[model samples]
Target: MGDLVLHLDNINKSFGGLSALSDVNLHVEEGTTHAIIGPNGAGKSTLLNVCIGRLKPDTGKVTFAGEVLTGRQPHEIAQLGVARVFQTPEIFQEMTLLENVMIPALSHRDGAFRLNATELLSKQGEVREEAEHILEDVGLKDMMMVEAASLSRGDKRRLELGMCLILRPRLLLLDEPTAGMARHDTNQTIELLKKIKSRGMTKVIIEHDMHVVFSLADKVSVLARGQIIAGGDPQSVREDPKVKEAYLGGTT
Candidate 1:
């Protein structure tokens, strides 16, 4: 573990009198994969939303690489080198796989995407080269020219991951990276994440699959009823009674 790359402190959020998060604090060390696991509606996604500026916390502070992210816009946070992969695959359905990846790379370099620059972006040798490289890294090079809509759910997830990789984010947050994958696809996704981990990219993952969590997470935090009940190295957190009871559906 290195210096803290992401920190959430004194966080609180509510919806019409229902508390969604309460005094939540989290720290993700640089170059490590941290898994946030919990029962449904435990505020895992909400926390991610807050970190990326999609949802405002009633009271809290989000810091990434020493910058306060609380009031920043989602795109602003992204421009600052934080990228998120949603629970559902978000991609350009009509665009070719290569083009889909190129769009982000172009936006990342130009600071914003322009419709008129679409053709010129495709013609950029450097951007196209990197996009092809990213597609290959995510195991989708063979289908680089195919439209994104033709891909399977697993392939789409891989494509989306490739899209994120083009920007080379400093911190990556993944919400259910393998949500609907079968065992085979899940294992492949895990392997892909491990590869990313080796490259020292910090990641915060919200995952429901215990297998995926255990396989990739160096540290684990369990959220229950909108609060963290246990947190530590994966093995210790897995053995914590509160975690077992709250997230694994076992008695404490």
Candidate 2:
């Protein structure tokens, strides 16, 4: 384990009279996968939103890579080496997979919107090469020119992850990366994540699948009703009595 790459302190969020999160504190070590698991209403999505600047917590602080992220905009957070992949694949449905991946690499080089053709032409080759490299890494090189909308659910998820990889973010927040996939596709995703883990990429994953969590997570934090009920290694947290009682059905 390395230094803390992400930290949340005294976090709180609410909707009307209902609390989505309360006094939540989480620390993710650098170069390790930290899995956050909970029941449906455990505030997992809410916590990710706060980390990525999608929704601000009513009270608390979010820090990433030693910089405060509580009030930064989504793009600003990305600039700070944080990228998020949502439960649903976020990609350009009308564009080719290659184009979709290239857009991010281009944006990473210049600004998000660089309309100057002269400047773009000068940098186009480098950008395309980077995008192609990313596509190859995510197992989509053969389908690079395929329309994103034509991809199956599993391929679309891989494309979205490839787009994030183009940015080479230090911290990746994945919200159910293997959601809605067949067993074969899920296995592929697990292998892909394992490869990324081998590269020492830090990730915070919120997943309902224990197989995925135990397969990848170095540390696990079980959340319930907006609070952390158990925190430890996979076996320890899986065997915790309170965790089993609250969420795991008392089974490992």
Query: How good is model 1 by TM-score?
Result: 0.95
Q: Write the per-residue lDDT of candidate 2 for residues 1-252, one digit (tens) a residue.
A: 678889999999999979999999999999999999999889999999999999999999999888999998898898778888998999999999989998788778875565667564445787888888889988899998889999998999999999998888899999999989998999999999999888777999999889999999999999999999889899999889899899889333
Whole-model lDDT per candidate: 0.91, 0.90
Model 1: per-residue Cα lDDT at residue 18: 99
**How many clashes would you count in candidate 1?**
0
For 52-158, candidate 1 gives per-residue lDDT tens digits of 99999999899999999999988899999999999899999999999899889888888854566336554699988999999999999999999999999999999
Off by over 4 Å in 2: 111-115, 120-123, 250-252
Provide the lowest-lDDT 10-residue window in model 2. Answer: 114-123
Superposed on all Cα atoms, model 2 deviates from the true structure by an RMSD in Å of: 1.7
lDDT of 2: 0.90
Residue 212, model 2: lDDT of 93
